[model samples]
Target: MVRPVTPASAGFRARGALVAVAALVLLAGCSADGEADAGASASPSSSVSAAPSSRPDPDAPLDANQACAAMYVDGGKTLEERIGTALVGASDGLDGTSADQMHAMAMELGRLEPRVPEEFQGPLEKIRVPFLQLQEALDLADGGQVELDIASTVAGLKEYEKLC
Candidate 1:
């Protein structure tokens, strides 16, 4: 007679399988050597050094506005993660309300989305709403609203991962 696995055991096996697959995928898509990965820019003038000889160099460091577009061309890598990290970085200096911080974060995230996956184009579209709410929260300091905004951001992030 064959023994059957329980639900708990099966779930563990499934989780292990997922981890293995993710690892393989990551390994398969390693970024080119000697160049800064899409999310990690070189320095203040990183754009200038990276521009094609035919294209004019950007005057700024990382153009938050152009960030998403870069992500789109980066082969649909960790666009969501890069966006989230960039937002958190922008929010770091703020002492204002959640709305203010999240608004800033969302703007920065928007700048970064063009570089993300094609699938993320629409889901990220909805993120603007929560971001606006976040700005309002900054004025009101609604901690509850802050939590909601983060939840929405995370939800959008989950969509990005699937695109990869």
Candidate 2:
């Protein structure tokens, strides 16, 4: 015996199909490594290669002009802007956005600390210390420590800016 499909049953089957498709789409984006694969049209650096190295000597000290250029090439300005914005926002209130920014900036600096020019790494590290403390203060709502750490971070940044 053959049973005719009713409109209601057809609609329910269509909805179930749509849900399965959506689930597959979402699962396709998930990765065990927690990193998404960039599209094929992404920037060149996103791909790995075995090209010869042309980077300058990491131990060599750069002149002010070179130092500034290197900083920009290494995304220093972007880091500073993000960290500064986080500091300012955290100063107003210790909210999730501010805290996330601070944590992200701190982790970024930790990764970049070793990559900076040898001469600037020390001062760069000094600035990172206060960033850590600022994150902690924000988490704890310790306004007094936050103010002091902010001052210290500003001072460290000024020193680093001189190298730039």
Candidate 3:
């Protein structure tokens, strides 16, 4: 017998979708050993060497390629890895620690926004926006919003894939 979807049922479906998406993103970011793939730097035009430190120089100007390299390669922990970690954590449960991690990653992206080339800003913002929204939804215990936030985050990650 076909059953009309109720609000409660819809919430459960959304939560399930969010969990599936989070798992996919996390798996995409890791390898068999569960470590981030070192060679998974985003740029395709040329090979960029890892920087001495994880962070780019705040004082120095960066081109789009250099900025992309700094974001994914220079850092021992790539931004992609961080995003995967945060999303998986949030999907596991809306705990205080997971919310804090999401906020931290969003802030990290915010700090890097100005340092990157002008072309990269929009894509970066796309990813950052959902991170913040998801954190807020978690704090508020909004299940529907949490699902929407996660979908937005996945979409944002797709946008970022084109940038690098």
Candidate 4:
């Protein structure tokens, strides 16, 4: 004959099953190299460095204004993030990664400059001076100068964003 389970015993069994499942899930995430495997991949839309080709063509006649705005908006967040990282990295210490990030941002801004609309050209141009200054500071490992340039770049970008 089978014995009747008490309420306490039933609750304990249910908790045991849950704990076992949790352990299996945790273990499944571990790789043989002792690194945890990435479980979920991000979609392209969630990526920061999305392709510029997906944006409208700057030279295209029909929608030049919209194209310019789209181009700027597309890369804005990623550039801002890199700039912030560079600033923080400088403040904390002249970390290699931080300087590298700032360099990358300068390159990206240079690439995007030609796409600026005539109407927005002045503001984008304003940004270049500080951007170059920031890069120079990074190269010389001048944290104080880097901090000042980062602030200037951020302010210019804010105005640029307002245009779009």
Best by lDDT: 3
**Tens-place lDDT digits, model 1, residues 63-122:** 432443343334444443343433343333334343255566567556644644456666
Higher-lDDT candidate of 1 and 3: 3
Which ten-residue region of model 2 has the weakest summed lDDT?
1-10
Predict model 3's lDDT versus the native. Answer: 0.57
lDDT of 3 by residue, 1-85 (tens): 1111111423323345456545655554443112212233334323346654555347576666566555555566767667767
Where does model 2 exceed 4 Å of error? 1-77, 136-148
- Model 3 / residue 71 / CA error / Å: 3.2
Find the candidate with the highest TM-score and give its number.
3
For model 3 the TM-score comes to 0.60
Residue range 1-164, candidate 4, lDDT tens digits:
11111112121122332233233323322221122111112223354476756764445542333323333323434344444444444344334564566566667667666665665555556555544665665456533423233334444555655554
* Clashing pairs for predicted structure model 3, backbone only: none
Candidate 3 runs further than 4 Å off: 1-56, 135-148
User: What is model 2's C-alpha RMSD?
Assistant: 20.4
Candidate order (TM-score): 3, 2, 4, 1
Error of 1 at 88 (Å): 6.7
lDDT of 2 by residue, 21-101 (tens): 234323322321122113212334533363556554765654444444433333434445555555555444455675687
**Judged by lDDT against the true structure, how good is candidate 4?**
0.42
Clash pairs detected, candidate 2: none
Question: What order do candidates take by lDDT, descending?
Answer: 3, 2, 4, 1
What's every prediction's RMSD, in angstroms? 12.7, 20.4, 7.5, 21.7
